[model samples]
Target: MNAPPDIATEAADHVRIVLVGTQHPGNIGSAARALKTMGLRRLVLVAPQKFPHADADAMAAGADDVLASALRVDTLAEAVADCRLVLGCTARSRRVQLRELRPRDAAAMAHAEAVAGGEVALVFGRERTGLDNAELQLCHAAVHIPANPDYSSLNLAAAVQVLSYELRLALLGAGGEMPVHAAALPAGAVPHAALEGFFAQLADTLEAIDFHKGRAPASAMRKLRRLFVRTGLDEKEIRLLRGILADAQRMARLARDAGRA
Candidate 1:
């Protein structure tokens, strides 16, 4: 089970590029070109404002196949419904509390997930507004492109190209190895939705016990969510955590009943 994967083949089979709320047809086509250049063929378009236009085909250059085969969906959740790992690309100053990872790190992580026989997604938001806070929250973690501070407004296709390049580099590492920490990562890792559910239950358990004192419970919850994400909880770990939370909730209920009696 420790054999190195055929990086390109695995990436093509398990990794997907998700463009959410794309406003430009050219950008979509350019993103396809980027993915094709990096040997990644799967593309998913979510609620694009403009698509199937002449401009898109024209901009696709020689990579028209990627654009032609791209999957179109209505929402980001739909785009990544089957993916075990979803990494959203966002600017660094979004003020969203997420585990901020660089492009290289994110690429490596995505590649590792793909190698583990799990589907992975690299999500890019709109060209203008980028991913809103809500959309960002849906992702397992956020990738921050560390561009120059003076002018950080990266074009949609350009961002895609940059991340694609990083993914390719990560995949094309020496000796067919994808430079991953497979030993550290847990076995049978759960999907992003499971982690989200755990976070919700954790918050509920905390609230039941009056664990948060301040008026900003959401703030505390956000930090706790980031902490758990960084710790990399797998399916069994998540189940264990959920059991503890349930027990805490039951204990709290008993305490309340005793007080009433």
Candidate 2:
């Protein structure tokens, strides 16, 4: 009989590496190679400029299996819709107020989420400008790789390789046991899509109640998003919050009708 698979490899199977707006097919291929080398199998591509190109296949080399199974989606949200934990790998911090984690810390967090039976995603952005503020909003946290400040421009594949290597090390260090903090995490955390739905409802409710009062809602919404995401809400908590929002909307509508009367 074949030997059983190791705990680390099993957990890795639940993690997906997401690339957004990649401009080069060769980089995708090289990224695939890097993932395969680190024992990670799943790859998600979001709005790549070119795929199914000879350059990608050529660069993949012996990592054809990883390339062949790569999933292509139109948007980053769609790519990570079902994921319970999404970490964006960025070279530097942006305006978004997400918790920052080093590569090793990120790897450990991702590994813990995966081991707890949740889908995890490590998102990478475009080659030139990196992930935009809107894109960063979808992520629960940011992973920063500290490089020389004078020359911090890292290739997309190189960034992927660094995270992949750290993740592999994290998995190996697990020693076949769940991390202590993993047990404290809420079980059955809602996926990204569900949380997004809540945010949409929240915006609508705010509008109904005139919370913004002719001012731009962008700043308020950004702060609200940071507050809620930091709490790591579960499915039950999301449902409760949505229920409150629905009631608020109804009350606001009634108030408007009374004023008209």
Candidate 3:
């Protein structure tokens, strides 16, 4: 039996496949083709190394429509600016300490969100390195395909195919029923851009307060980013945090002035 009409419609409309810093144009085209096979239409490209090449068109085969409608942006944050549920597809080893789910589990979560009228993004990183720690922090969770342990390498397009196939199954209610964690979702989640703005202010505030008393502070900032992202702050919460940061910045400046006097 086919998927319910509503399920199929939500699957195509609410979910988007985002490729970040793609190195090859052909992979973009091939990934588009993969989504087409599973009735997924939305595709977003973030700062691809090469695009609009004839090779990409050739690789797309008959899925020209998917490529034609693909949205191109300068960064992964921009690509998924409005999506409420973002999942980063990563192949990093067990040492990486993010919430990891298999492709099917990830797809089921994404499917449930989409069905609940939330925008969802499935983010795939560069072909060579996958997502860096900073990029992974932007997503709510990490998706790891459970390939063979000894030879776990999978191509970019192939990874897309695996996730897309599982997503299709989830939407169709195939392979039994998928659980929906509706109660855990945010009540009024803000856009990705809002979180980014807060991060910028936070960095400035920390700098003014001399929070990172060291030669280099990149590592500290990375950990802080992960800490805040894990909270899944909504718009009101973000505003509250920013207000606090602004006050901290003002107090820091006052203290500096007092020391000068």
Q: Model 1 RMSD to the real structure?
A: 3.9
Q: Model 3: runs farther than 4 Å from truth?
A: 1-3, 93-96, 179-188
Error of 2 at 130 (Å): 0.7
Error of 1 at 209 (Å): 4.0
Give the winner by lDDT: 1 or 3.
3
Error of 1 at 140 (Å): 4.0
Write candidate 3's Cα lDDT for 40-139 as tens digits.
9999999989988787899899889999999999988888888878888998645345667778778777877787787899999999888887688677
lDDT by candidate, in order shown: 0.80, 0.88, 0.83
Question: In candidate 3, where is summed lDDT lowest over 10 consecutive residues?
Answer: 179-188
* Candidate 2 Cα outliers beyond 4 Å, as residue runs: 1-5, 174-188
Give the per-residue lDDT of model 2 (tens digit) for 1-261: 221458777899999999999999999999999999999999999999999889999999899999999999999999989999899999666578777777877787887788788999999999998899999999988889999998998999999999999888777774343445433433227899999999999999999999999999999999998888878888899999999999999999899999999
Q: Which TM-score value belongs to model 1?
A: 0.80
lDDT of 3: 0.83
Candidate 1: pairs in clash: none
Tens digits of lDDT, candidate 1, 112-163 = 7777788888999988888887678678778889999899889999999998
